[model samples]
Each structure stands twice: as C-alpha cells, then as structure tokens.
Target: MIHFEISSYNPVLLTNSPLNIGVVETTLDALGERLLVIDRRGKVITQRLVPANNKLAIIVPFEYTVNNNLMCILLDDDAEKDGELVDNVKAAVIDMKNYTPPV
Candidate 1:
C-alpha cells in the first residue's frame, strides 16, 4: 500500500475560497474514510487506513523512480467530471516494491 500525508497536498492552482478539506495530519485518517485510486490498467491501488474529501482526488499522470524500478502510477480513470469520486489519486506515491496484481 502507498502512504501519504494530507499535509503534503500541493494545490495545482490558486483559489480564493478556503479548502474544504481540513488541514491536519490526521484528517486523512478518520474512520469511515473510503478513498481509492485505480491505475490505467484497472488495478486498485491500495492504501492503509487513510482518507480524504468529496473530490475525486486524482493525480495527473507523472513519473517517479523507486528503488530503480522506474515505474509509473496515478492511473487515469477518465472520469466524466473532476472531483466526482474518490478514485485514482489516493496516494501521492505508490510503492510498487511488492505489488503483485491479482490473477
């Protein structure tokens, strides 16, 4: 599972309105939080007992290096609308160290 802190959220754009999401390290850990992200291949990226807001919380496709794997994540669900559902973008970084897709 990938791990991330809500405090690390970097707003992609400026906004005059206050962010609806509470600014706290524990904000993503509340009970009943059901955040999820699916990869381009449709694999469910897993996460610990973490959480988030009404937004779909999707991360734009980006590349990263982890232990020389040179892997890519942040699956694009192609949602009809933005921030509609808690899909791909669940974690800032997905650790593929031991990930094995289900058969």
Candidate 2:
C-alpha cells in the first residue's frame, strides 16, 4: 500500500470540493475518522462513520501503483486556433520527502 502522511497547515475540511480530496475506507474507529484517499482519476473513497465535519491528520493508502503521466485535454476551438495557453506549460517531476506522522 502507498502510505501518505498528510499535514494541513490550514483548517481545511475534507469535503467534496474543487480543492479537497476524498477518503477511501468505510470503517470508523474510536476517533470516528478514517483516511481520505483520492486517485489520479479523481475518485474519492472515505469511511462511512467519520462525520463529514471532523478534520485531522490522516493516512491514505493505495492498493495500486500511481501513474504520474500528465495528460492535458484542450478544447477543439483552442486547439484549432493555436491557443497560447498550452504553449506556456511544461511538465516535470520532482522528488518529495516522506512526512512522518506525529505521535
């Protein structure tokens, strides 16, 4: 499983939003929470009992490997007109350090 140690600097709720991702598991615990998981395809998985209001540190695990291939879909009009929006973009990969969860 792919483990992610998540830390939110701001008070952000893991809800269905443009900026927030979803959890994957459906089991609840004494803390009444579970990990929020999101895939590259934008699928959200979450625990059923974690109140939608509680926000805390979560560990997200994935059953499969992640594909980092970046794909961009442009509108037909933009593509035909040779829009400048796509010209300014470049894709690259950067190494990220694993964040250890606090005890």
TM-score of candidate 1 on Cα atoms, chains taken together: 0.22
lDDT of each: 0.32, 0.31
Per-candidate TM-score against the hidden true structure? 0.22, 0.18
lDDT by residue (27-92, candidate 2, tens digit) is 223343333333446554332223444333333332221343222222223233431111211222
Q: Which parts of model 1 have CA positions greater than 4 angstroms off?
A: 1-31, 51-84, 87-103
Clashing pairs in 2: 23-36, 23-37, 23-45, 23-46, 24-45
Q: Model 2 — which ten-residue stretch has the worst lDDT?
A: 83-92
Error of 2 at 64 (Å): 6.1
Model 1 lDDT tens row, 30-85: 23334443454545544323324422333323331121212122222344333323
Q: How accurate is candidate 1 locally (lDDT)?
A: 0.32
